[model samples]
Target: MTKIPRGTIAIEEAVLNPDGISWMAESATLFNTGADPKKASSHGHTPQLLDIHESRLAKMDAHSVEYMLLSLTSPGAQGEPNREKARKLAADANDWLAAEVAKNPARFGAFAAVSMHNAEDAVFEAQRAVKQLGMFGIMLNDYQVVGEGGDAEGKKYYDAAEFDPFWKAVEELGVPVYLHPRYPQTKDLERGTRYGDRKQILGAAVQFHLDLSMHIYAICSSGVFDRYPGVQVVCGHLGEGIPFNLWRADHWYNKPVKKATRPSKEDYSYYFTHNVSITTSGNFNTAGLKFCIDQIGAERCLYSIDYPYDTIEEAQDWWKGVDLPADQKEAIGRGNAIKLFKLPLEL
Candidate 1:
């Protein structure tokens, strides 16, 4: 094992059970993860994704990572079309994660999955996951897939007046909500013919960030933060390209067009700085880290590997060489995550 780093934590790690693999493989329509479950193990990362024991924990130990905050992977329950099935998948997945995390609470924490299809049920499940199962926070894969088998009719994002109850519950619970990424819905995918040439990069390469950033747009532009300002939102891939465009976003939100349509009391950058956090999950570029730190400061940036998808060796290799002061590195690499997520890790 590598020399132990002091209190290092990865905030956006993903986990899924065998049942979830089976379900998603068979039912998944929106994202490529479910494209063909039959060849699931073909990715060669299944052992890493499935085993928190030897493979995962060993990787963490090998890289000097002290702890990991796990969450249901993308297109988890949120991809299910049936509300009841989605609810069950969420509860079961959380329970399974809780059981696994119970085995090594010191090395692992988890975010509970929820179906955004029903605001009320999602609120209840979020409460149960935190209160009953001792989960740390909630995970939402962009939006709810309400349409049966990936149709465009069932798309739902929680930015309207209707999701107030859910937002209110999250604020009351005091746990951060992680806004993770997923592929565009089938309808949007159809419209994405503009990228027909290199559409191969749609899911995780180019479009995943584009797709997830829109939900971030909804969260900010739709006034969810102005009302429940205490609710914390986290995004991977260095703020999902927000920090790079914060200036323009702030300027545009102040313009008449955005001002008339939304109820946000502050500029886009205000809510982003006050209520959101970013992680170095997959995009581990030193320049991006430098830029985000310059834009949002190190306090709102956290370290992560987007594990199984992003290897520990590669993330650690890049993170170890990040050009910054020791204090800033400590803050982003670990301190921020512990404080923001209320992680039980000791400094």
Candidate 2:
């Protein structure tokens, strides 16, 4: 196995039970629970499997992954309708994650789960996760699905003024926020499925990333970064299409366009430089990774496998051999993660 630079960490690796209600599985089941028995079967297994130390250690050994920053599976605490249930679930998930990380401190760190529905609870959990549990950061599934009329059509967003308390607490805590993707809104379902069955899957992957990316962009453009300059936000799957079309996004910003938000000379790319980062989980394409590096710089990239949806061996095999300058490779493989997460240097 190839050796990466010392202190390399995969910041976006998932840790969840197989039976957990993952956003991907739940969204797919939206059509018919019976249509896909596989969905129901895999629901609770994600966290259990992700928390298994032996399996994760074996995977790390096989892949030469020195450290993995673990997060609760998607929609774990985010999908709950009751705010109190959401809070309890977040606490339960964080407790589980903390214990799992304690099992192998040298090889693991955690991203705490928080219920965003109640901003106060979200802040309290954030503090507990970082200050007490020693988690590296917090993982927020795209948007807080609060009620029935919260989609794009309804234009309800977590970044709205109502959620400032949550954002303020995040800033105060001084930990990064890993914004993971979730399914698209119901209003946009048809647009996502126009291609085929594959389109729905592929499009959802594409759309979820874009949705999260745009939300972050909105938060940034809305002066969130300016207010809380020290706060860091991370996205997975190579920044969810932002790197691929950054130039187009910038060009459009320059052109005349209707703007609900005030136009600023600063482009979206500017914000990424100061406050954003991304990981390579579930996106193993070398060409795309290289492109992302070129667009965002290696300092902003981290390596991840998106396990158990993806195998560590496969991601490691591809990443360990990708063609890039040694400095760039080291940064993407581990240096960036170490610096971003403030991980201990043990490798």
Candidate 3:
């Protein structure tokens, strides 16, 4: 029953377009086996995810969330087979989200969804979203699926040379791309882990973050930051469990069995400290948050309520009860988010 501090900002909340306004219908079709991928993906078209009216505002007020940074639900436009289709979907989704944010600018901000299937279109859409639509930043749902129909085998990673233009665009745009998690169906199939089979269990809980952590590490190891030091990447769920095992990864990198020329000048931890940030989204573990703060410092850690997935009340209560100084709590609750997203708050 602890009261949330005033002016708290909640990033990483998701929205659902139940009336076929955005790309949900098309993108949901990609996962043919699921029970209406939209419902399966977002715990069904809940009132919270679909509501942008008083219902949503009421929830925010109840939780003392001043602003909520919203994005499209998972596998959004990223899993589309056709690049052109993906481009259109991304544009439509962003446009819809922009309109929603425009309604209540004081209470809502947005993350642009770009078509990662086509690098050129992705850059163009990102530019349009940030420059024209006035989105706070971009949110990529894990890795992108590349290739034509029935060719969902190919995948796109940010660290690859092919994504250099996209990375360069992000750096130039000066907007942090929140690297959010999506379940890796291909990995589940290859490893026979049944993540895809059990959407209720593995999609959000296990395989999603695991797949994203590897992608995050790939970006770190592949020297993406070395080339574009200005760009910032964000990982949710307590660094996707990355901060806890940095020493082991760094040690292995320092003494590689098959040593070769490395792309990055320093190790993964260096980039994490310099160019990466983590959020307490969907993860309310106080011990984990303390460990992450200890590892990366509170300045690089932000707070978010994974709305509709985790209640804003729950997040607020947990954050309120944490055994930290008021300044440190404020940094995690609002200051870090404002600094990272460059929120134009009048405070």
Tell me, by lDDT, which candidate is best: 1
Give the CA lDDT, 0 to 100, for residue 336 in model 2: 78
lDDT of 3 by residue, 7-61 (tens): 6788889886664434444433333445564465424445567887677788778
Can you write out model 1's per-residue Cα lDDT over 144-191, one digit (the tens) per residue? 888675354577888967899999999999999999887654555554
Better of 1 and 3 by TM-score: 1
Worst 10 contiguous positions by lDDT, candidate 2: 195-204
Ranking by TM-score: 1, 3, 2
- Between which residue pairs do clashes occur in model 1? 147-154
Flag regions of model 3 displaced more than 4 Å: 1-5, 19-43, 149-152, 186-201, 256-259
Candidate number of the best TM-score: 1
Model 3 quality (TM-score): 0.89
As for lDDT, the candidate ahead, 1 or 2, is 1
Against the hidden reference, what TM-scores do the models get?
0.91, 0.84, 0.89
Q: Which stretches of candidate 2 lie over 4 Å from their true place?
A: 1-8, 17-39, 44-51, 148-156, 184-199, 202-204, 255-265
Estimate, for each residue in 1-347, the C-alpha lDDT of model 2 and write its tens digit.
Answer: 34433534677777664335454355545433245656363443445455558877776876677888888877667766567877888898888889878977877889999988767888899999899999989998877655554352323356577777877887888789998876545554454454233343443355566567778777766767766678888888888878887888777765556344553446778777788888888888899988888888888888887876677788888887899998888888877777777777632
**Clash count of each predicted structure:** 1, 16, 0
